[model samples]
Target: MGVEWVKKSFLVILMMLLAFTMSACGNTSKAVQKTEDGKVIVDFWYALGGNLGEAVTQMVDEFNASQDKVHVNAVYQGSYEESLTQLRQLAGTSNAPAVVQVFEVGTKYMIESGYIEPMQTFIDKDKFDLSQLEENILSYYKVDGKLYSMPFNTSNAIMVYNKDMFKQAGLDPENPPRTFSEVSAAAKKIRSHFGTNVHGFSVVTHGWFTEQMIANQGGLYVDNNNGRSGEPTATSINGEEGQRWFKWLHEMKQDGTLGDYGRAWDDHRAAFLGETVAMYLDSTASLAGTVTNAEFEVGTAFLPTADGMDPQGVIVGGASIWMMTDIPKETQNAAWEFIKFTAKPEVQAKWAANTGYFPITKAAYDQDVLKDRYNEYPQFLTAVQQLQNTSVTPATQGALIGVFPEAREKVVNAVESIHGGADPIEAINKAAEEINAELENYKRVNQK
Candidate 1:
């Protein structure tokens, strides 16, 4: 609870907008910058708050402390949406930072912006080995099959359970729930034994939770050609599998087991830590923060599934470092240096250790320090194991279309319908229709 803990440097940043259709910032698309003071002042916009901001700053401080030529000043911009808005105001303005942290969902926008440098060329010229990063992690930043952003700390959802609750329910905590059937069974047992004192399971479906469920069911949330492939003019989200996931949520809600809508990952954790929710599934990054303060012994498991299907690949989460194209070459180069430096193994392993995000570099995962982490906290290994075993399935990778935030909100509005007595299938079908219409509109407006 110390101030340092508040700023501890490597926390996963979540900018939950509740509703996705916020007015986006006016395009900061291509501007130029001039240099001053012989010290290139590289503007760095970070989305992390508290100690996580401190962690990013810790590295920024190191970069600054290491040399006098480039002065990287770190700016904390509230959340991803807020940072994008700030960038909008600073766009074409001299105050714009050279580097801004962008969430994965914004990848398509940044690539189309043409305002940032492509990372592939940067690596080839700088002799930065792109091969050092695992194939699974590297796919998150690519556009048109070329790298644009450097993969930083990455994570995926992991199943979390209250061990005491599981134990009271006569469930084996060590084994945990591997598939959806087991999850249903476990929930029933917990409810049967602990009554309403404990929960069988709960998942806050905002942000990428819906997509994660799609991936969990071995289904794709969006097609490769964006939403175009799923249907000529619709989405495939209300398919049998997607409905199954929603049905599970609906059942949980009806059984007095599920939690609320609009409860973000952090809010759910706050609830989980408060002992209100017995089981939760969320980002791997949640472990370190929650474990540090958890009063009960928490258990971790691979995200569950149904019947014969394996746990589908998990989608990548966590922010990436974005370079503004308008910044002076010196500042841009300096920003690249910092990005490349952070991608190094030592720093990555340290980041992984500090935050639950899996290291982007294999070296970090193989590092002695990180290897010891698994030994120290077996529960922490779930995501690491899951991500290692994972693949870049279209479902897990996510959809790429403009007005992404808007589309995500439409999905939520469908989710909200379930509480209002609407059928899950009907609600999802309505959501896909809305998404397809918006998708076409976005494509039309942002046409190249």
Candidate 2:
């Protein structure tokens, strides 16, 4: 009986040891991986795919080859929304990536999540030079006079026009419309000359365009100075600027000038590429794709402003690189090194040339490579000039609310409602009401 009991105990101990080994093997996926050469591996999860993804991979490879202390593994985690969801899922876990590229709208939520190590933390610790950064681009990521993230790829909304269509309509292809009134006039001419199959203006009823228009007028989207001062309590989108903006869209739709592309930004791009739209508002980052896809001469300009108001600026649209907390000190330091390397003027110039995103450092514009590239394609310089012209005001600083992404969807809904013949003011007011309620609930739940 004693021998039989010993045999049973030995078998149980062996099974437990096997289970332990399997568990250890399952946890090999880590943010910072180590190589056989004992070099620290830093996993970088990014949102870009396709050509943009290829550019990022090249940058990562160059970064890896340039140094032996750290190896950055760039992982494509799908879209920005998907990447943010994955990051949230991995919070407080060992599986989180050491670094992430978060979009502009996700700024407030990322800050509230408390899972990131502010860039200021490292900048202060290492006494990094912040003076070399682009002041306008960096200002968007700042909260209370402090930068929380490192600007990576920054872009602005620009007007992409079909130059051939402009010539056909007898409008000056060299001078695109600079105001909403001028846009309407040009669209009218385009429609009149080219008939119904061609659209004068096409845009994805995206809240982004609306936001850009408001910023151009030096207006705010949410109260509390576009959420820069404190926690935003209410949305001011239904105010004068928003009303006039939506009214223009409604009138354009009524006049058969503005063609609705629903909420899909890609559809608007396709329309432009297909030569179905004369002018559209899209990100400067899409310039490369626009130039590649369109057979006609494509022209780029700053987003049109309201008739009376001078253009203040368009809000920068793009993501910035953020470091996660709970990572090893060594890993954090290594990640900072990679970020700094990427921020170098030459590196940024190459990235801008490849991805069509404006370089985030002013010095990048001074590089001969970037200069030559800009000379060849002067359309690239429109956004650069716009960014330089834009001042860092609270309204232009961009809205920072924990519920901004959701609120933007509501704004889209409002725009769609207006396109569907709903009263612009009423639709905007209703959307604002819904957004304000959501913000209140969010504050209560998050205890912010």
Candidate 3:
């Protein structure tokens, strides 16, 4: 009986050992992998969707094919907010991606997050020529005289209008409105000519538009030079510049010429395409798609400024590529190599043509691919010219607030409130107070 019990126990122990070995083998197979040729693997998390996402995947394929030293695994992580949320959870972990794409407004948060390796480190180490890139785009990513990330997919707001509607309204199709008053006048004329069938002008209930309007008038969004010189203690959106923007919206709303499409970009674009709205503000990144999709002849122009204010320029509104610190050193270097490839003029030209984003490298303009694209879509020149014509002041450099996403939400609420007949001054003031409180809370939590 004792011998029989010993044999059974031995069999059980052998079975447990076999199961453990198989589990260990499965985990090893699931671990991060390298190419058969020993190329370093890089995991890249991106937020763009639809065509933009496809373009990113294409670029990654090209980059992998161009080099044998590195292989990048591109993964779609959903919307910018969703992807950032995922990163927040996975950051500082072995599962974290070697590279991540973060939106422009997340700059301050990223700088304070301690999860990234500033692009400046790689730039300095490799002596990369930042002068080769667009200064206006770079200005937005630079903090305290250091570039934190590499600019990719950069865009600015522009006014897109239907030339057919403009001519019908007795307005010059060649020359679009350049100021708030001009836009209002044009909008009223279009509405009057179309007679209840169409509205004059519409802007998406987005905070980015408000930021652009204020910046165009050389107005700061926050104190301390838009928070670049120092941490901002308060928002300046309640100032004269901001008031002018709000008042313009209020007047437009009162006139019934400003279409209320809510905040969905698709809704606003649909209104324009459906000819329910004559003109609207949209990102330059949408230029190609808008022109291709519009049934009428489309015209592109610079964003309107407040009357009597010279255009300070629109801030670049897009995402940049950030390197993660939790990645292995070899992987980081591989990621940097991929980043440098993305910045190449040829690559930038292809990306710009495919995505309608401004090529970060100025030399991309000299590339035949980009030149051909510009020639084919002449409307694309307006955005590039607008960006080139902008003065790199603190206002145009854009605001840097740790709570910028929250602040933008407040501004959006204020715009909606004003559109809903709330007093513009009161709404603006309330939004400002809310943003200031958020900034204070952020500083308190992040104080070091």
Candidate 4:
């Protein structure tokens, strides 16, 4: 009887132990997802929405179908700011994505965050030929002589005008404004011809336009070579170039030729489409949509500079793909494979054609897809020419400050104030002072 009881107890104990072991193994497998064939799974978190999001998902599907080694799981995480905020909370945890798309203004913050692996590391390991990419676009992502991220969707500010309206106003349709004074004059003429029913010009009261305007005139947004050389101690937006920009808008407002569309991009674009505004400043990314939706003929031109100054060119405004550091090396490699796939000429061509962003890869221009797109929408070529003509300088390479997003808000506030009859100099000076204080605080916290 005692022997039978001992045997029953031993069997029960052994079954419980086996059950626990099996459960542990199942939990470990759940930590990192994999395909049935044991391919590495990479998590890609992107911030693009609407058609752009669909495009990203399509690319991921194509990549998955093309390869058997890696599977990419694309996740949309909201807007640029929201995505970054989520990353801040999830970083250094297993819940973090292997790759993320960060905007241009987030460059300094991402570099200092210590949460990402420099793209140069992978480039060196794989002997990647960066020369195949566009040099001007690449310059924006290179910092401290190293490439921090891979440029994906790139764009520059351009002037989109109503060619029909220009003719009606007795202005040269072929000769759009090339200087601030020219734009002001043209705006007045446009308003005069159309009367109070339409405004001559409008730009969304966003700081990005202000940045591009300042940079186009060879002006620095901050000291220390726009923070490329070292940390920026102060903002230079109150300088001569910035003052010219603010003053230009002020004069137009006084003349009642400028449309106040607030800060919403949609509102400004709607105004242009609705024929409430004759000309407007917008990103190249809007070219395709605006051209497709507009009833009147659309003309694209380079952003205007000050009266006598030659245009230095506009800064690239878009996002780049970043690889995270906390993930396993295998997953990181998988992320790299996806990144390389995104840069392929065929893939980039498709992306560019579907969206208005410039393909970072130079070879994409040679692809039939992109060529067809350019042929279909000739206005798209203006953005390409503008970027190619841009002089690679400290100003044009764009500013690098950890507080860039915040600083942009300050600039927008200054613009609103100036339009509301505030003194341009005083409004600009106030913004600069606020940005300087923020920069000092950022430096203090980030100091090693």
Error of 3 at 259 (Å): 0.6
Tens-place lDDT digits, model 3, residues 43-108: 999999999999999999999999799999999999989999999998766677889999999998
Report the lDDT of model 4 for residue 27. 20
Worst 10 residues of 4 by lDDT: 23-32
| Model 4 per-residue lDDT tens digits across residues 1-448 | 9999999999999999998776445223325568899989999999999888898999999999999999999999999999999999988767889999999999999999988999999999999999999989999999988999999889999999999999988999999998988998999999889998799999999999989999999999999999999899999999999999999898888889988999999899999999899999999887888999999999998898999898998899999999988777778888899999999999999999999999999899999999999999999999999999999999999999999989999999999997799888899999999999999999999899
lDDT of 1 by residue, 21-103 (tens): 22132233323333475666777888887767777888788877887677777889899899887877775446777888888
TM-score of 4: 0.93
Off by over 4 Å in 3: 1-33
TM-score for each predicted model, relative to the true structure? 0.87, 0.92, 0.92, 0.93
Residue 204's C-alpha lDDT in candidate 1?
A: 73
Q: By lDDT, is 1 or 2 better?
A: 2
Off by over 4 Å in 2: 1-32
Model 3: lowest-lDDT 10 consecutive positions: 23-32
- For residues 167-280, write the lDDT of model 2, one tens digit per residue: 988999999999889999999999999999888997787778888888888889888888888788988888888888988888898889888888878899999898888899
In TM-score terms, candidate 2 sits at: 0.92
Q: Model 1: runs farther than 4 Å from truth?
A: 1-37, 225-233
